[model samples]
Target: MDFAIGGMAAVCAGFFTNPLEVIKTRMQLQGELQKKNKQNIRYKNILHAGYQIVRHDGVLALQKGIVPALWVQLIMNGCRLGFYDYGLSRGYCNDKYGNVVFYKSVIVSGCGGVVGHYLSNPFYLIKTQLQSESAKAIAVGHQHHHKGTWKALSHIYFKEGVSTLAVIACAYVE
Candidate 1:
């Protein structure tokens, strides 16, 4: 119940925010770690980046990572909200007087968020990689030729091992 509602709400938010996310990813990846050169600039700004993606890859391009994005949001928010609600119900966030303790609530919610983030990190990695892919002319970042989220996950697991997944998640934090 709580999980479902939180997941659904996050999905809706993710759906609307994904395009901006796509734009942001591309912009960040463009000319990454390279010397600044005017010629290398493909996306001038958010609007231009969005326009270029639409012109070259169609409007749907803006939602390239929607599947993984939705999954990330659903899993992360579901666990987070569910855990928080469970804590509240169990009085884990309440003081001896039955008043909600601010520090206890923060700790409970933060733990939930951490758990959710850890579980969903793989999807987030896939989402960023997928969103980074674009037409060759407009492509930015190291393009990972992932067929889909599942394939990417499998490839990483099989080729890189389980530790790599954890490493990736940790690296994302830094």
Candidate 2:
């Protein structure tokens, strides 16, 4: 199925993009927490942080969040493509000649992204939190942070409710 192709491509994209995503997360967290005003928030600044990481922690440090990121990306992209295909096949999209419009295809795709992100939010949050500078000291030996995915998920649910869906929704929009 074309959906499988899309899913595989997305997985590939996710793998390649994840390192930069980790760097971006770390940079943003660092910038937010530091007292000094950041002169630049450019990609170059992220690269500089990456360089610093390599200097201090070795190249392996650049891949600190790889495990959780891989989990999230694979699940997210797989479900996204699956849901899109489901929606399209269900006639959520229509053919031309007064049947269905292809623009509906875009809508289905967007919906797929939303659903996939929602399903994958806990993994994403954990990956981001794990990768963040602020989380490092606090999460060290912390039971909650070290807990399994389901446990972390239950914790998030207890803390945020369905309103947590808003965060995923916002991410989808962005």
Candidate 3:
């Protein structure tokens, strides 16, 4: 039960972290030269940056990445907990008294992280592309290419297919 709760917590944590991640990625993708000239860029914190996004784009802007973010989180946490349970039940988490203490399962849990990410890479790649500034900019007036997740995925598959996935996997291997 504790592991189940922990998995749910992980899901929620992933959900909340995504908005800030969206902001951070956008900041990092901006021109370095332009960023270097901005005085406030160095000193501004997450709150300040979030405030700027809200100020310019309103409250709904914070939730731009929430859909894919939630999906990724749910899949990740579900696999993590499921695998942890499997490991524990399979004698991989035996304790001093042959009892499975929760901490003894950390190794299995960490492996679960890697497995979950790899299994879910396509989802995450789409998530990243959806949140990308270039895509967003192109989407401003181009409604045809700006379909929601499922449709956008079909577009990606039609245009790039598994090569897109292979590139992402290669990057991870590197």
What would the per-residue lDDT of candidate 3 be over residues 1-174, giving only the tens digit for each residue? 534665578768977777777666555544343456632242155676567666665666666656666666766676778778878878888875778767768888777766666656666666666554333322221123334667766777788897876676556534
- TM-scores of all models? 0.93, 0.67, 0.68
Q: Per-residue alpha-carbon lDDT of model 1 for 1-174, expressed as tens digits?
A: 888999999999999999999999888877573455533788999999999999999999999999999999998899889888999999999989999999988888888788888888999999999999999898875689899999999999999999999998777545
The number of the candidate with the highest lDDT is 1
- Candidate 3 TM-score to native: 0.68
lDDT of 2 by residue, 67-124 (tens): 6677677666776677667876777777645366778877877777776677666677
Instruction: Summing lDDT over every window of 10 consecutive residues in candidate 2, give the lowest-scoring window.
Output: 134-143
The order of the candidates by lDDT, greatest first, is 1, 2, 3
Candidate 1 local lDDT, residue 75: 87
Q: For candidate 1, what is the TM-score?
A: 0.93
Error of 1 at 99 (Å): 1.1
Runs off by more than 4 Å, candidate 2 = 1-4, 35-44, 96-100, 133-174
Prediction RMSDs, each to the true structure: 1.8, 5.2, 5.1
Worst 10 residues of 1 by lDDT: 31-40
**Candidate 2 RMSD to the correct structure:** 5.2
**Superposed model 3: Cα runs more than 4 Å off:** 1-7, 31-48, 95-106, 133-145, 166-170
